[model samples]
Target: MNDDGHPTAWERGVLERLLRDTLIEQRRARRWRIFSRLLTVILVLAVLGLLSTDVTVPQVTSRHTALVQLNGIIAPGTDADADLVIESLRAAYDNTHVAGVVLRIDSPGGSPVQAGRINDEIQRLRKLHPNVPLHAVIDDICASGGYYVAVAAERIYADKASVVGSIGVLMNGFGFVEALDKLGVERRLLTAGAHKGFLDPFSPQHPEDVAHARALLASIHGQFIEVVKQGRGERLKDDPRLFSGLVWTGAQGIELGLVDALGDADSVAREVFKADKLVDYTVQPAYFEKLIRSAGGEAASALVKSLSTTLRWR
Candidate 1:
């Protein structure tokens, strides 16, 4: 159309460029479709995997020591929570070929209620399966409520260096009255009950509230002492410092009658139970939950590493 009926050079060049652009665009579209389909398949598989993580009892053909790990803080919603431990203990007892059971504990302890629940469940399971003896193996530190859970076991083992015992209850918190004053912050609290605002951090510490708190702690401590005495019986020594919130090394614990002997989970499985092969009966969290928790822990670690930034921001 450029003054002649023949095809012009410029018009031919333009056609070639347009055709190349269209081809490239088509290639891109095809790649994107493939990527979308791949993503969809991955998402479906992940969903299925997460949904199928429920615990199921498996028949064992050989005798083994069933291991149920109690790690981290003994709080609700944690790995060492009562529910998971109870389920693991039940599962360990349910399996027919289990020669013995081991509750491996590595915790500084938290939530006395959670620990008590686990202790009670352990006792119940042991009573039902008396033949399958269960032993508590302390890994690193097992104090406070951790000992509460361990006391229920038929026998407790630990490494020579492992920390054991803190048979006491504590309800600790900060008194921020001075901090609020420095920040020019006013605390306005309302409650229907007379002691509803007990141990309020922003208010001045009341002698009555302090006395009440001490009494509550003493009651829980007394309960803890009773449980220990019932479980340990004559194994525990008559020393007053035994239940004074003082931790002792496993070797020292044996001397104090807090630990049975110096041995790890492996030794207990091999020597005490005579079963070298160990089977894990601990109920694990779902994959998705684990990922989420791992991510949260990493974020928390990062935040802690940037302590100055966190303080400044607040």
Candidate 2:
């Protein structure tokens, strides 16, 4: 016992040994935790590396070029976008091992601007690669924008039951003045110009606004018709309704001269391109991109739900 009534030197030795042993254990535990974290990081890095690098390079033969898929809606930043598709097409065209390309299209159509851009790209690529033939294989449906894209190809092929051809423009919306009145809701809109709110659904529609919109649509529709005519050449049948925003079956499409032949992807690949091997260059979103997108969607949904609940309660 010391002067303060504490442990003696011998007693302090045992106490220090116990404390030292506990400290050592704690240090070992921390080191193990750090090692485990480092191992996890290494494993994740390995996986990411493996996924980022393309393991299999597409084998191109002299028989034909790479086959590409153009499925889903054709829009900017989408799988069927013109810029992305064109990049792949350029790759196929530039590939010395490939002889030609077959574009497999399956879509209900989207964005006239996007389709037009794609059409121009395809035509330009074809001009550049005059010898390498590019053919279109229409799957389920290739209407409107889809048909527009197919027109740029050397020939359009589809099954007898496939839906095709809606070479027209459409703008859809609704007027809700009556509904707002029934709900006793007031719509307050302020605009800088007289025609700024011309198409406001809450207010009564102006005849001039309707006329203006119609004119705009008509102009777009005319452009679409001209493109189709240029693509089909003199093969287009005497059907005025072809550009009336009316879709048709594959057989009907052929009759209207919208499609050149009737066949599926495999059939076109085998008969037209003469190559059975298919290579898809459609760029998919990266894992991190998908994660970020999913997280963003979740956050947006949660915010919307919170807002909806608050509005309902109020």
Candidate 3:
């Protein structure tokens, strides 16, 4: 309505500009929609590809050294748990193209139960696949439960300076009775059995409980010694201090008959297996799986910490 009830030129220009901007916005939205659809498609394809293939290692047709890594605490929920390690071992032994299986151990040791399970599985697999020998290659430190599992291998190899060997059991806890007394605090614990709270850290030390614990530890230690003897056989030297929960360097390990030789995975793979190429068979958990496992592990640790005032072979 510039002068006579008709639209002005400026108003028309403004309307045209608004329409142009609207069209441009619509184009941008459409482009973003297309990009989003493409991204979704790509994600779906990637997930399907992972689901179709082995979750552990890529399939190889050529003969190579099959590698399984045990690179953490050997607890139930840890990466070096018996289930995962044993599963990888099974796959490696089942693979006909695998020249030899290598257990790349870089752990400071953990639960005895988990270690024992892995050790048992390795021995069973060894007997089943007599041709494919399994070897343990220590990276940094393999002590306590780590060495227990390593002894099951056909041969143990380590670097000259790698820390190895801690062949003993331990149960660690803090006695808070003195602190409680000093603070004038009393622990009110109730149990059905007389010896139910025998090893409670907040309670006074009981001689009978201590004796029982020592006996139990000795029993487990004897079992550990038997397994070591069985695995190393004549290679292990008859030393009284060998099972005294002492850690030794890799060179010392070789001298004390704790380690078979001083060699790394690369040299062993090249000379022993004659296959320079190595194929990993360790199971890598998915993102969600890892999240769930982490949560569960945290819960378990809290529970164990609260309740485990007794012995542990760590």
Candidate 4:
């Protein structure tokens, strides 16, 4: 509508420009959506690739040494726990190509129950695969529960300075009765059974409870002594101090017949297995499993701290 009342060329040109810009914007948005979808697909593929790699079993050779690491605390939810160690042992033993298995241990020891489970599994696996001799190569320390696990091995090797042996059981706790008395606090604990709160730190110490605890520790210690005797057999020295909860250096361990040889994993792999190639067969927990376990562990630790008074292995 120039001067008359119809339409203006300038207005129509402006409208066309606006329409073109709208079309461009729409195209850009569509392109962005496609790019985002492609990126998501690539990320998913990468995650799948990583998971597959983790799940893949290593190829073994007849001349290769299979390694199962027992590092860190040997307790439930730990790397050297019974479940993981046992699983690794099974994998190493099951592989027909593996000539020998080595349990590389570097632990300060933990739960007796977990250690016992691992020791039993090792014995079972040894019986099943007698030819594939399993050996324990101690690192810095192999004491208490760690030694318990090592005894199951056909031979135990250690460095000259490696600390070995702590052949005993103990249950440690702090007495809070004095502290409570100082604070004028009286612990009002009610139990259905006479021995239900026998070992409570806040309560008065009972002679009968002390005796019971000692008896329990003695029983576990006897079991540990029996295991060592069975595994080492004639190789173990007939010394009373060997099982007196004393730690000895690897050199001393050999003298006491606690260790078979003074060697490391590499030496054992080369000389004993006759193979320099070592393949790890340790079963590591998945990321998700670890996350879940960590959360659960916090809750469990709190519960145990609140309830359990005794019955723990150093």
Using lDDT as the measure, which candidate wins? 4
Q: Rank all candidate structures by their lDDT, best first, as comma-separated numbers.
A: 4, 3, 1, 2
Range of the 10 consecutive residues with the lowest summed lDDT in candidate 2: 305-314
Where model 3 places Cα greater than 4 Å from the true spot, the runs are 1-54, 289-310
List lDDT for all candidates, in order.
0.84, 0.76, 0.86, 0.87
Quote each prediction's TM-score: 0.78, 0.75, 0.79, 0.79
In candidate 1 the C-alpha lDDT for residue 188 amounts to: 97
Q: Which ten residues in a row have the lowest lDDT in candidate 1?
A: 305-314
Note the residue pairs that clash in candidate 1: none
Report the C-alpha displacement of residue 36, candidate 2, in angstroms.
16
- The residue pairs that clash in candidate 2, if any, are 65-100
Q: What digit string (tens of lDDT, one per residue) describes model 1 on residues 72-112? A: 87775568768888988888888888999999999988777
Candidate 3: tens digits of C-alpha lDDT, residues 1-314: 67798779988899999999999999999999999999999999877665332355567989899999998878865678688888888888878999999999999988888899999999999999999989999999999889999999999999999999888887767688889999999899999998999788889889998998888889998888899899899998888889998889999999888899999888889999998899899875445545666778678776778655645454
lDDT of 2 by residue, 29-114 (tens): 99999999999999999768644423234555555547777877676545676666767677677677665678888987877888
Question: Of the candidates numbered 1 and 2, which has the greater lDDT value?
Answer: 1
Q: Which parts of model 1 are misplaced by more than 4 Å? A: 1-58, 297-314
